[model samples]
Target: MTNFDRITVDPTVMSGQPCIRGMRLTVRRVLEALATYSDRNELAQEYPELEDQDIKQALEYAAASLDDRVLELN
Candidate 1:
């Protein structure tokens, strides 16, 4: 599957949070990890279920989601 295809959402999983390959790992969770860990390698060691492509695509997907939104400053 394409890296983007690795992202999926199901109400039964993670209470409908966006997840990777229908697994318990949510995209948001991974993105948050990026904040604490500077190296992707450390992330891999932390979450063995994650592949490089999974991390790349999750960022792509999250960025795309934000691009679709509009934020206004008051």
Candidate 2:
């Protein structure tokens, strides 16, 4: 697994959902935001606390999570 140093999971935060550096901002949310924002500058304007590395790790973490999982087709 890739080192997701920026991704964190704390039961006290967001019900243990994977987050960015233990912040309330979730990896899922980051992915969603990425889809909404046309550019990194726009994303940065929206989430000032989020750094470039945080975004990078969030993407990496999401990819790793999917790679480690299996889903049966209905």
Candidate 3:
């Protein structure tokens, strides 16, 4: 998925932090929840807006972003 499509930047939302599908849910929040929670079912239960695919997609998005990064020193 394109970063522009899956992730959005809107000043009104979370101070323009990158979010999933322009929703109020930020990627950082999602990742944190995933890291702390062991049960996907429990997570889905707590976050009605999220599904298994959403969680998976968020993880994939994070991974892709990390993989594409190149540190440059000038």
Candidate 4:
């Protein structure tokens, strides 16, 4: 498994959803925000605590989560 140090998951946090640096912010939220805000500056302004590394890791984590899998076609 790829190491995603920035991404943390805790049952007490966001119902165990993948989060950024154990923060209240979930990976899903970050992805949603990225989609909503095309500009990185705008995203930073909205989430000042979020660092570039965090964003990158979140994207990586998300992709890795979906990268390995087996699908059965009906």
Q: How do all models score by TM-score?
A: 0.81, 0.85, 0.71, 0.85
True-structure RMSD, every candidate: 3.7, 3.4, 3.7, 2.5
> Of 1 and 4, which scores higher on lDDT?
4
Quick one: ranking by lDDT, best first? 4, 2, 1, 3
Cα lDDT tens digits, model 3, 1-74, are 54445667799999998788789998889999888778878787878887666677778778877856689999
lDDT of 2 by residue, 1-74 (tens): 68888889999999999999989999999999999998989999999999999989998888777746588999
Let me know the TM-score candidate 2 reaches against the reference structure. Answer: 0.85
Model 4 pairs in collision: none
Off by over 4 Å in 3: 1-4, 67-74
Of 2 and 3, the candidate ahead on lDDT is: 2
**Better lDDT candidate (1, 2):** 2
- Candidate 3 — what's its lDDT? 0.79
What is the overall TM-score of model 4 with all chains considered together? 0.85
